[model samples]
Target: MSHKRSFVRRTAAVVAAGAAAFVLAACGGDGNGDGSAGHGGHNATASPSASASASQGQHNAADVAFAKGMIPHHRQAVEMAGLAPGRAQSAEVKKLAADIKKAQDPEIRTLSGWLTSWGEEVPAEGAMDHSVHGMGGMMTDEEMTELENASGKAFDTAFMELMIKHHEGAVEMAKTEQADGAHGPATKLAGEIITSQSAEIERMNELLGKD
Candidate 1:
């Protein structure tokens, strides 16, 4: 009878041990699952926060000035270029005008986008007026008016002269941006402006027999 009682007690202890081990394994699985979920949640939250910080922190005052100033400066150039197709005599002059318009219009849009994203005010559509003429390469109201009224070889000559002056101003402004701007994209755009406008300046000088 004592042997029978000992056997029963041993069987009960074995069953109890097995249940404890099963419970521990289930608890460990739950712990691991929770840990994995926590890590995933942290990563998801961190990514956009880091991206927002990068976007917001990347630009500085010089970059803002570059974008704001360039917008209106480019607008005036586009306005000047627009007058060429109807008025210019030389095919080369007309082609140059078209190229100027094509290039500057997109840049104006990009500058405006940057300003908007940075919570800065974009220049108004009429902002290309004489109020901005003090900016590099911008023409006065009278000069734009004169360009509008000219045609044929006269228009070509006037266009080249005015555009050369305008391009020189743009190059100077771009150099300033390159030196002072903190934004990567803005400084890169400034570099591009210096290269392209410098080339255009040389081309226009050749056209005017001033090279």
Candidate 2:
């Protein structure tokens, strides 16, 4: 009788221990469906995501200024190029204008998108004052009007001269961006602008017989 009582007591204690362990195991799940611990639970950290990391990449005031200033600058160039189709004397001039429009339009959209992603205002969307944003190769209203009114060889001469000036201004702005801008894409675009626009300037010079 004594032996049986002792065996019964040991069995009862073992069953109690088993029940406690089962309860602990059941409560240990993190509820994230992965059966992990402390994840998606109270101990999860407030860490930033990969996308947030990408967006936090280097950028500064010069980068911002480059984008803001260039959008309207490019817009004006596109407008000028649009005028060249009907007014230009030479087929070469017309093609040059078309090329400028083709290249700069997409670039304008790219710059605007970057600014929007950065939580900055896109220029020429009624956000920026035109006077302030005319920092790069932008023409004033009077100069634009002069181009608008001219035709034939006069239009060709004026377009070449004004476009040279415009290209020079863009080169200057791009050099500043290379020196001061922090964002990689902005700096890259600046370098490209310098290369392509400098070449265009040379081409225009050739067209003007200045080369």
Count of clashing residue pairs in every prediction? 0, 0
TM-score of 1: 0.73
Alpha carbon deviation, residue 11, candidate 1 (Å): 46
Model 2, residue 151: displacement in angstroms? 0.6
Output the number of the lDDT-best candidate.
1
In angstroms, the error of model 1 at 189 is 0.6
lDDT digits (tens) for residues 60-174 of candidate 1? 8889999988999998899999999899989999999999998999999999999998899999997876568767968888888999999999999999999999999999999
In candidate 2, list every pair of residues with a backbone clash. Answer: none
Residue 122 shift from truth in candidate 2, angstroms:
0.5
Please, what is the TM-score per model?
0.73, 0.70
> How far out, in Å, is residue 190 in model 2?
0.9
